[model samples]
Target: MDFNKKVIALLAVALLATGSWSCKKIIDEAPLDKLDITNAYRNVADADAAVIGIYGQFLGLQKTYILQNELRADLVDVTANADPYLKQLANHTTTKDNPYVDPRPYYQVVLNCNDALKNFKLMVDDRRMSVDDYNKHYSDIGALRSWIYLQLGIQYGSIPYITEPVEKVDDIKNLSAYPRISFEELLTRLIDFTEKLPYKEVYAYPAGNPLVVTIDGSSTNKLFICKPFVLGDLYLWNNNYTKAAENYEKIMDVENNNTNINISFNAYKVGYYLSSDYTDQSVRYLRAQDESTLLVDAGWRTIFSAPNTSNVWNIEFLWGIPYNANYKPGNPMIEVCSSLYGKYLIKPSQLAIDNWNAQRQYSGIPYDARGKLSYSTTVAGPVITKLTDNIVPATNFNRAGKWGIYRAALLHLRFSEAANRDGKGKLGWALLNTGIANTFYVGTYVNGAKSPVSFDEINTMQTPYAAPYYFDARSNNDYKSPWYRNTGIRSRAGITALDISLQNNVLGLEGKLIDEGALELAFEGNRWPDLLRIARRQNNPAFLAERVYQKLLKDGDPNASAAREKLMTPANWYLPFDWK
Candidate 1:
């Protein structure tokens, strides 16, 4: 069936159905046409399938979403055989006709979410869904809908806002003529809608319920499309640093919301888990035919590996989406860069490689676990190895890398960024907990006397580093300086300690946090957005241009000057779309 025709039919079903809706026990073949869409709420199974179908639509967005977020950023560059659209995006020269800019896929999801939202009330009234479940789904649908709008707003600047689905032909026609809303307004709406979701508890289908589904081995949680997480993103983009940090903390801190839910953060354990031994001479790092292990960050890699039930609810994945080859197009993200019958559409830029190297240099560290783990060790180049599926060989078309929507590490990185926004006063806490610093302090004024601040006092105040220092210093009669008052920070005894590096200064702190983000989130489709947020926060276009220039220089890009100048234009920062 043609795409538009299918959409029309689906909408018709949403609007016109009057009979009982029934679906097969199997989710993949939910018999949308066989069941009455309007009456789908008549039973628990049907209502569950309806909601699952909305997730299914979101799952289908891997290809476009990855390209839009990753390519335009400095992380990945296009290969020779890459689609022109991909190249256009990589070069920051996207035209109005770039197919990737089309808003249809997002709208399809909106339609699905709207359909579910419109009918879910009937499910609650009819006892097909519990009132609690109804509230849970209410938030779910709202988050998903807001996410689509947010993505559209981010990618294309302004877009027509459609909260309700087009259930009739006239509705479709009317929406087609709807004027575009400003990005600010779209963000406001997105935040408002997502805020309507419950932030207290995570929601999941009952274990035996047919409504339950898995993304890889990890099961689904309606709360995975979480409100706080989405709202944090909206707030982050809106430059509301304090709010963004608060919301993100709700996900990463776990202690707050995961009261009954146990979520742990194993930073070293979060990368791709490759076999301990593999002899692929073309692959870097794994050259030895023996049982040689490549640099592995198992926990970090786990985020992109085939879902493991043991780690499904792990704190590493604050919010994530798993791809099932059986359900949707097997994650196109992994295959797009492989030697195995892949388009090799995107490859990591030399700058991405340099980013890892630079961070290593800054910290005087020899090997960056993330750099070693994320980049291909084999001669296959610097493109990330984070998302490869060990179950699938590189000789095959599908590499089975799970795409993550949000990870706990990413939250930490962004929280650090959010904490550092201009005049936000979150820097002290951000610095303490980003876990990037090794030494900290406790300030004291003995007997409330103006004792001369001594180096020994500062040195003696030092404590071994720990993130989220449970206590903070308050600036008052006891502590006069911001540095003295900073949480978990006494004061550096001296900057001359060869082994004791310091980020006590604001610029140094921001630079370290940004570098940490680059190192940890290299090709995870976040580099550009990270840059954008930082640029806006600092109110400096130079942050955006200089970073792009550095990437261009590292990548040895020829149009560095042209691209740098183009990047200076705020309008060009966003892609052009053929809205008409």
Candidate 2:
């Protein structure tokens, strides 16, 4: 089909619509009748509209993205009310005819991005847009396109790596003209493309700009994709461990001066401690002091349920797409996961519950707070509320929620993955289990003698390779340094630190990181990709196949054996690319 023709049709519909774009926070209040194909790149305003239009089209892919990424994984399962397509996804019986397998929506967004990139360059050449503005817009769109392509490669395995705008979808179908590249090749190309971009930072919009909108009193600056995050992932996937760790450090270290240990990006941490009470239940979990009194602690749940403006929420959510009920496409997750007022098509699997239940909290609690608050067992059934907590009986039909793309926890986990591979396994493990303060030590002088010290006293001396590699978690007497504020990931969840004796080697620690990812970010659509990436990295099909097989078998699926046998072959892990 002619993709540009569809773009024109959508643009016409958008011109007549009154609602604002849902995901990107770009409010297009200006008249679009004059912004036709001919003059879409004439000036800055027109260029901005074109970019917003691309995001507008991107809003439609949220449902497919989540389903494809989650259903095929081990964390989520199809409900009785789910359609055959969803069941097919969960069962690994997906056919080419499944609507979710159709790659048109993804390619549509790619076409729009390609068109925008081409026009932005022409506008620059014609002196219609300034160099700085061109760099910002170009880099943003480039990173976005690369991200979409990355998703496509992950889901579909091999894809036509088309960079230029094409007249028709068939153009990409011709393998001779545009050869399909493997995921590894695609990663190399994406890293090279993203690395060469002029802008490497998040897109900075002017104050009060609609793009920099306020959703629930929080600025949407984090919604825009960061170049470093994309590049970091690319490098990590490509097995360039050092480069991946360096790129991730760029986001973790906001001040860019690792030597200045005091000024660190503490918000990226999962913990929320400011005092000496390491086992303080008040900051970690809610407990009953007496029959009449119940203490409240919004520890891990706050990451999902709290408003974007809340410091507790904003600190962790690095990038999320906010959905409004008044927009064209409301939050699709409500219908997919909510059992109250929408079609509960999917639910959390028993394996996920078992995994969470097997853990012990730091306070010796039976369950992890994250799993307890992630999803609850309702009278109807088990519902996934991580993304649909905003929906209630009052406004059930008109639901509004957010689709989380990247968060600080995920970033930290990915960074640890890269670091462990790069021979920093001990540091990576410390960051994941306990804070650096507890894991490392230093010598302190008392009067005239020197003695070994840990935690607070260790703060006086910097960590080994304190520049870009080390992450300090010590809170000195003053408690003023940014590094002091960060506790480890498990510390934030009120969970006990992982036993280093059980997982001391790099391979064992890599497995721990993957498990930690599932525990921290199960339903946010990273499970399958994580499993697949690691399985591919280790060249162990059993790593991914066994988890999926167990999930199906535990759920009493009849096709579990068949799916396991099929997944034994790495090629069966991806969706079939037979879109005609």
Candidate 3:
């Protein structure tokens, strides 16, 4: 490649990619002037840059991460225009030659975290940072490193989990002696690492302070992966339901319940109020420019738009990957899914579409609010709208938006599954109530009184009562129904729906919970893992094979029989990684 081409390639791979892990080679070859770990901690600004650089590594990983998680699942299928790379991933036939399959990028992120941890103490001892800040950095870097390892373990099964930085060629050679750690071991480490963090009850950036300052001087307050949320997710994966619930309770503000969260295009200026109940207080803190749009409800569609701005920080979202329009090669989802630029690279499977439309509450509308809001009707089929929008200008498009890591809705469903698995009937009931209906409509008035309804009250209302009470109640409070959020729909009075039934058997419950997860987290990148989790939980590969069978059948694939046979093999659960 020419110099210009090589620079462009590096920019595309290093800056544009978005996976959670990084390559060791990427770290080894990164220009010293750009990072310079030795002198990087000389001052507070230097330390800030070092930490921010680690986040940048995530920006590079976001695209790959979302694809690996979403495309490999049964819910979505690649478009006809999709490159061979994407098609291979969607078809579960990826080869070692596939450009996107490398784990080196993720290893790069781990190495970056190691370097930061290694040098941070020097800064603290030099009095450049307060002990509190030092502790925070330690926790932050530790949490980030563990998160990368968790992703690595999930994707690759086992990896050479390294904690030390590879400063020279010798370090790389020595790494060959390190043995790969099991996924269970990695999860245990994550649990321990997150528990030891400062354990702040709540995480909010200092008032008026930016969450992280970018290399170009832009700033944002998008939350990073915090302790309770990470720990809770790890616990859920570990099947420690009680422990998971305990960790989630610490940071999740259940009292302040609002499902429809609105974010501004101007992210740094937004201030989220931390509370326990959902009310006007949610909007009271939104920084308004002209006051006319002060409480202007951001469309449910806007949350996925570029410059995605979230007004309230409920326990729902654990962390978000921040994107800036000023930065080059913005969110990869937009590049692939946006109407203007996207050539429909990723398409929704017919089964996913059928599953979405099956819960129609009325004969008048063929699709639920989630179906309507999350997809666009094109001749090509239903294109994923959960992560793509056209509001941003074409020239300035692809910038601004965050990929959700772990949210309350997903966590709630996971807890519900875990509770059901362990026979914790009552706890499962409460978790189901809170988790599914955790939207903007939770704490609003009923009968003109400040009546906060339990999740069960809202979720279980019979048919003809309007999906979420009624359009009247929703319009009166400016609350969008849970249908748009994919939480669950309320059939009018006394009508039992497939999703509404609290099935008794474990398989029935797991199937329902799995469908709910697909509805709530379809394109946000958890579908494949959700499927694998359920299959593993039951110790049955048929659970997974059946889903794949459904997808292939829906696609009218002639090879469906053969594909199902191959997929039923136990070793097919997770793909083999290049490094391992």
Q: TM-score per candidate, in order? A: 0.74, 0.86, 0.75
Tens-digit lDDT track for model 3 on 117-217?
Answer: 87777778889877766776667777777777777776777778788777765455455467887877878877876777663433533433223323222
lDDT of 1 by residue, 168-248 (tens): 554553555788888888888787777766533433334534434333344553324656777788998997877887776
Model 3 weakest 10-residue run by lDDT: 263-272
Q: Using lDDT, give the best candidate's number.
A: 2
What lDDT does model 3 reach?
Answer: 0.57
Give the alpha-carbon lDDT of every model: 0.55, 0.72, 0.57
- Candidate with more favorable, higher TM-score: 1 or 3: 3
Global fold similarity of model 1 (TM-score): 0.74
Q: Sorted on lDDT, highest at the top, how do the candidates line up?
A: 2, 3, 1
Angstrom error at residue 58, model 2: 1.8
Tens digit of lDDT per residue, candidate 2, span 1-580? 2444344334423421312342122122212332224555778666666765666567567788889988999999998899988999999999989988888778767867887898899999999989987888898889989989999999999988878865443454453345789988899899889999889873335444445545434345565677788888888888888888888877776642435332233456545554322212112423422212222234455566555555656567667656655444477888788887689999999989888998887666677657766888898788988877654333655656666788888988998898888777767876787666556645565783334356546564335654457765545454444454556788777678887863358888899899988788889988988999999999999889999998999999999999999999999999988655
List runs of model 1 lying over 4 Å from the truth: 1-36, 125-128, 198-218, 221-223, 255-294, 297-299, 325-328, 361-367, 377-382, 389-399, 422-508
